[model samples]
Target: MLFYNDYPLPLLGWGKLRNRFLPDKGKIMTQAIFKATIIAAAAVFFAIFVAVVVPPLIAQPDVVGAFAAGFVNPYASGYSSDVLACWVILAAWIAYEAKALGIRHGWICALLGIIPGVAVGFALYLLLRMRQLKAG
Candidate 1:
């Protein structure tokens, strides 16, 4: 904007381009939804793992055997085993992608998340990745 002879004129320039291209509404809502869903899903996944795992551990005397139940025998069904296998594979892939993306603390997040539950690990990795993406 400039003033000449007490009259003003506004220049249409980079400011207009910046505002025109930037998103304004619903950005907060999108982030909030992502967070809410991640928290809810991760909580449910952890609860399911506990219910499926703890009872067997309590019923068995051998700690190793109890933990091993996740891989074998009357403890784990084929469906459960397949699901767990998928999670491991998926986590491995996420770790690879995270490294490729140069996300900080990616390995730690992947290990913790995958060891506890793939859903937790993946969510955490994604959250971290989102931050890194935004920063760059």
Candidate 2:
């Protein structure tokens, strides 16, 4: 039996460049979309937590003191150390997730993650993205 396949062929003029690159375009596009979605979601969650949860915690001196006494006192300075530890943990988690997702620059992801720790993660993420595009 002699049956013809229905798929369209590339135009005759495209040359080797077209053939070499065309097949991977779909894969690249899918990866890009996935990465964008993940970054966007992470940024949103980070922002919400920072803007909503952190300020009140900071404003309440009694709670802060309690947190310091329970979690910070044995270490050294107290509140600052606890904050730094929190930041480090947050950064590490971001780095881990970014690496897992095959992001090219994990440090940026970590920095963006830390924004929520300081109560500005969302704004930081937007600023970082703008800066990254400008630099690139």
Candidate 3:
């Protein structure tokens, strides 16, 4: 048996580090790290939304024009297209996983995807998925 940080690794070998050493503690640590990453991503993306989108929203409040601005140029259009595609991908995953994993409230993330952006919604979905996985 090998050792890591003074813990004995399982004889089953290198299949899974968490399974090999620190079992429950390792799983907890991994889950905490994953949740923190999701929260951090959501915070950063939401900050960008507030900084860039809120200003124009508060100033003129032109919802249609605000959306149109995303495709104003070739570069913007490309990025906008990518975001739309990503949202579609997320929606599909959400739909499938809701059925497969019995995860609830995924629709809220879908709505968030449209409003604040995909990153926030994606992070929220990940957190939800993590919770459901842990529960099951």
- Report how far residue 89 has shifted in candidate 1, in Å: 2.7
Q: Which of candidates 1 and 2 reaches a greater lDDT?
A: 1
List residue ranges in candidate 3 displaced over 4 A.
1-29
Off by over 4 Å in 2: 1-29, 61-136
* Candidate 2 pairs with clashing backbones: 115-121, 116-121
Residue range 23-132, candidate 2, lDDT tens digits: 54455457457557656776677768768767877787475564455464455667557667766775665466456643345466456444444334333444455455
| Model 2's TM-score against the true structure | 0.31
Cα lDDT tens digits, model 1, 57-122, are: 668767776546566765466756775787777667766775787677767666765456677777
RMSD of each: 12.0, 12.7, 6.6
Clashes of each: 1, 2, 0
For residue 109, model 1's alpha carbon misses the true position, in angstroms, by: 2.9
Q: Which parts of model 1 are misplaced by more than 4 Å?
A: 1-29, 48-63, 71-75
Q: Model 3 Cα displacement at 126 (Å)?
A: 0.3
Cα deviation of 83, candidate 3, in Å? 0.4
Task: Provide the TM-score for each candidate, comma-separated.
Answer: 0.57, 0.31, 0.76
